[model samples]
Target chain A: MTATVIDGRMVARGVREETARRAAALTTAPVLATVLVGDDPASGVYVANKRRSAAAAGIGDVHRHLPGTASEAEVAAVLDELAADDRVTGILLQLPLPGHLDPARLVERIPPEKDVDGLTTRSQGLLARGEPGLRPCTPAGVIALLDAAGIGLAGRRAVVVGRSTLVGRPMAQLLLGRDATVTIAHSRTRDLPALTRSADVLVAAAGVPGIITGAHVAPGATVVDVGIHRTSDGLVGDVDRAGVAPVAGAITPVPGGVGPMTIAMLLANTVAAAQTREAAR
Target chain B: MTATVIDGRMVARGVREETARRAAALTTAPVLATVLVGDDPASGVYVANKRRSAAAAGIGDVHRHLPGTASEAEVAAVLDELAADDRVTGILLQLPLPGHLDPARLVERIPPEKDVDGLTTRSQGLLARGEPGLRPCTPAGVIALLDAAGIGLAGRRAVVVGRSTLVGRPMAQLLLGRDATVTIAHSRTRDLPALTRSADVLVAAAGVPGIITGAHVAPGATVVDVGIHRTSDGLVGDVDRAGVAPVAGAITPVPGGVGPMTIAMLLANTVAAAQTREAAR
Candidate 1:
């Protein structure tokens, strides 16, 4: 009675390889400039993985190292430098800076064209307007995985759990654009279990592990887990891996689910950045 | 125990009169350039009403009347003309244009500064970013009504019963900015009543009449009805007026509740637009 497991690692590899091929075809080698701030171990791990993935994806000009503990002005300066650099097609600033920094204000300084992370207000505006542009990688990955699964979106009842600006909001927006009747359910939502029971597709992005259990899921629904948490026990997502998998039609696993896809999409976004040189011109 | 009724017509008159005073004070009256395309009777009535309201607010330089059969290029041309107009502080393209026309696209053509209706992507972005800027009238009016009523939003549960860009989405964003634990419910939402019943403040913006009934409302919760539908009996709202009023602590009447607030906010936005000029100087 177990549901199909969504193999995100393999899917992400395919996506990265595809991006590599496309990137190699481009006249100029795509580059990603990542500006890191403060010594957050998680941010360090993420940035390292991204640089490695970029190189593996044939984005050969990737800048692998940036100083940790860099001030807001310094980080913005690095972004400005990269923005002007011909080699760098995309710029991503590792987030949750020191106490004194205004992260959103610094983010606004990144030119929209180089905003691969899609956290910029302008990029969000573009997404809300349903225009083609660089999208938030996590949400973009969710859609890519769903599209890869060949799931029909029309008239489907999709309940997205979480409403953060980064992932949940944009995911609901993308789902809406694909014509799935989408509703965003957040932490404050009452009877969350009851709501999940009615969903044809459930997207768990709340960052709360084991929030959606077996009893909560509708029978035969595709579930995409966008949450990745590391506990003393192990890697887990917002959805209970064992509990909901049996009832769900297909489900994405935790460590392998959205994590790898995040890097792959970042590479894809770089290729997209380079392609804009032609598509927009 | 009947809930206190919030009067909107009276509030709207206050807003309109304030606008009139400012308009009268201006050496050269501010103009509201209204562009309408394709003769939809409802749209015609709406635009004419806006013109009368503009005049009543002492805003004399109202450039009313636009072609119904205007081409996209022609409409854009009008928008461009308005954008260049020094006297026009507010430019609004009346909604639901002809089949071939894109209302969203036309809304973009209005200069962001002159986008008095606050439907442009830029304005929406400003709202999303929690920046100082113009806002959508209906949603802005709802917030203003709460403020006017001396309602405190801190640590409150705000339920916005809709998800459209113009009202529901922005309303939720506004409430989030105000520290309300916000939830957005819609047609696809399961057990919508259970969700609404927990709200300290309930906003009905779904445009469906008699949707939020007595059973759906929380006892002593402030109810702000955003829906205004013409029923066979008369004007109606998403909240079941008669049924929910007695159970609610504060209720906004249909004709007098959100309607006047909309016009008042529109006038308020115009004043804000004028103030921006001085700030720029």
Candidate 2:
């Protein structure tokens, strides 16, 4: 039997529409300050899409672009300005900052309340403590995707492949928060397929192309592929879709799946940040 | 084959001796300020033992005991004093604060630098981000125990039975940080034995007595039991020792296992805090 393809674009639109409604209800316009350091083509595309999504959601976008030669202190100064700006409700620092700049230090400059990207130590700490705070977008989107599909996470044996701070680690924490028995397997994991075969829910975020084959999945288990690799044939995911689709119960496609959800969650987070600031006021 | 009993007391002694050597090299004595909000018999005993351990490690012990009727503000005040005191290298606010007080708020009052207990959100966040910072004691102790035993965590299947922020959550993160395939299983986990049996290194921190038996263990898998329940029959661990011993390669006994390691880690953290402060000075 073929697997049911989870429609991420449709889910993302729903999220964007919901976020727009929330933005309309706010007393003041929600402003998101987007900091883009350097002219990396990929980073530029990501920023442009984020800005477009913010506009669609009725959120104000404040773009701050710096040259490839911008110093760490200069980037930090821009973050400090946005963080202290009363008009700014959220801040997003487009990542992969020039090799000279330390992303962690710059991310920390975004005050926790306004940290829409949720890459700061404080935000991660809040997630770790299970406290209320902005969550990292990709993992948050993954959870939202699962919820939208009506997949029950509680008590499910969910296995996550990859342990990157941006996705894998937080993804495991989110699943565990929902009472799923979450396991994280990285490149160093022994007998990877053996472990994946035991998972009722499998998430692949190893950033490797077509790492998961049909042999890696348990029969009738849900698979969420968080990896997207650009190949001569275009975008490919971690899962070997052709091979695994017939065996798995459900799966998310590469470009349209986790990618759309990430943008949608960013919009949601921005609107949520505005509401939080408003409530505090 | 009978399992090798992990001698936690012996390991703890080694840790303390190493900590004492470090403390002796310090320019000034490292002071650990223990703040006991109420006269909880158990808390008092724990605090007393911690003080005794600190003394043995050549660290200074400063005890602050408040009445059980203390308000949240009063507890905060005590923590505030310890945080600002230049003499206090580390601050430990004993757990199970009076029912009236919110432990989270009081725990947050301890400065991150002096937060020896590592219960604050900042410390937990630093851990999540894999930034170098103080870690929660119990899980840190568990890692120390594993290291002292020459147990290789990398690429191993490590299952942690419990998801507490204090133990299970951090324990999973530590193992994941070390490149172990880490899984967090809680009360909601289905087919617990099936999961535990897959673990090369099984950690039981469920706080339930004798929750893991021989049937739950994979033959030759190392078991670390973190639960200790005092019954009329005497102290019992999460693992049914008599039943699991023959099947396991290595096992840690109840009282002599995690308990000593925890105290030893605390001393290590205290000395480390002092060193950090000294370096900054």
Candidate 3:
């Protein structure tokens, strides 16, 4: 374990403290509207964590939980109400909705200013245009982690595995925004190892557990694992930690790395929305 | 000169013919509202060509020419009028407005539904999300050229030089959408030749004449030159045509390449916008 573990928990704590300080200075307290459509146990836990973190950061949390069989219209109605609410500074729509619900339509209902999760087309569009707006939490968190580690992205070769709109795509855009020569590789990419080996900064986000090994990593490259899978033993990431740690320069741990940073970024976005709304007013 | 030249003019003719057929079949005649805010000779020529192309494609062209001293507010007013016009199927705002005007604000004035250039935030957002919308002209033209050449983009290593929103960024996104391992290299990127040499498909869009030579290109790679520089020695492209022809499997020329295809895609977008508007009605 010669590689330095990027301590996301420590950095996340710093983020929350700074967010709390900023929230206290605001003339109006920020309120986050959280909508959970189904009773997926994992989603429930995730929502609960966010609420708890919001409170700890001195922000108000407004939770709306619908039945598991809720229709898309029903969910959209909730989003519309939240969007029009003057008290709500940001909105978080818990993912993995019931099978029948159209998540895209529901996400579109949240206005770009209040979209804390940054999943709406407008937020993605703003990002694509390199405009200042609420960015996706996980990818933004990765940026914070890299900054915390004092890693420079400019002119570096960044290779991202995965192309999900939620993570990989936005991640690549963020890297590109910072002037990194970015390459996005997916399941269809040929000679994956050769591509990975060429990266100065490698981001593993394939969601498949233990998909990246030492052979797939470049020597002295910084690896940020964005995938997390929980099994009976414990939580694991997309990268083979034991195999990659010896070969990599820096690696993030599964439980404490990107996971904590995501919650922190959500809080940061909520505060930012509050500030932006206040300024606009 | 073993490389096959990608014939843009012939392909553009095919495209215009198809668009004319589609326009003729429409219940209502498609009308394009073009706003030219400056007296720049190049812009004037570009706008004139666009109108001529629109007529050839059986689409009505409505030209609104403003003086060089026109205010941003005035240009925006014209866009607003076009946006509300029931007969207007698509809106085109010519580039390089007056010195006092902010082009971004004026461009945003055109409603997303009628933004034929695909430069609006909403249109860009839709593309970033991989949703169906009017795409940028030049990048869409590049995709059309590739399809016409019987080149498969999926699983290929595609390298794009330059990161201008007009060409490189959107081009990378289009390639990525087609399952290609996409890389974006800009002026700030390190080791340009090494990076370009690794690509299966190379797109030169830096707007610099003769920036990419044979040594910078991978042998047998398909090269698309988006830059068109008018020099004393006639027109040239970003890729060194004479130097790269022997190395590349296929290449596009400066005069007959991307230049013709851009107007073709614009006509295609106008027809597509008309189809979408009619469907909504």
| CAPRI quality of model 1 | acceptable
| Residue-level lDDT tens digits of model 2 in A126-206 | 999788999999999999999999999999999999888999988988898898999999899999999999898999999
- DockQ of every model listed? 0.23, 0.91, 0.88
**Residue pairs whose backbone atoms clash in candidate 2:** none
TM-score of 3: 0.98
True-structure RMSD for candidate 3: 1.2
lDDT string for model 1 (B1-281, tens) is 99988878877777777777776776566777777777789988888888778777766455546667677888888889889978788887888888888888878888888888888877776766567778889988888788878788866778888878888888877886676756667776667787788788999988888899999999999999988889798888888989998899999988789987876787777767876764676
Q: List clashing residue pairs in candidate 3.
A: none
Best by DockQ: 2
Over B115-218, each residue of candidate 2 has an lDDT whose tens digit, in order, gives: 89888889999999888999999999989998988899999999999988899989988898888999899999999999999999999999999999999999
Which ranges of candidate 2 are over 4 A from the true structure?
none
lDDT (tens digit, per residue) of candidate 3 on B76-118:
7888889999999999999977789998888888888898999
Where model 3 places Cα greater than 4 Å from the true spot, the runs are none
TM-score (0 to 1) of chain B for each candidate: 0.95, 0.99, 0.98
Give the candidates in order of lDDT, highest first. 3, 2, 1
Winner on DockQ (1 vs 2): 2
- For model 2 the local lDDT of residue B109 reads 89
Here the TM-score of candidate 1's chain B is: 0.95
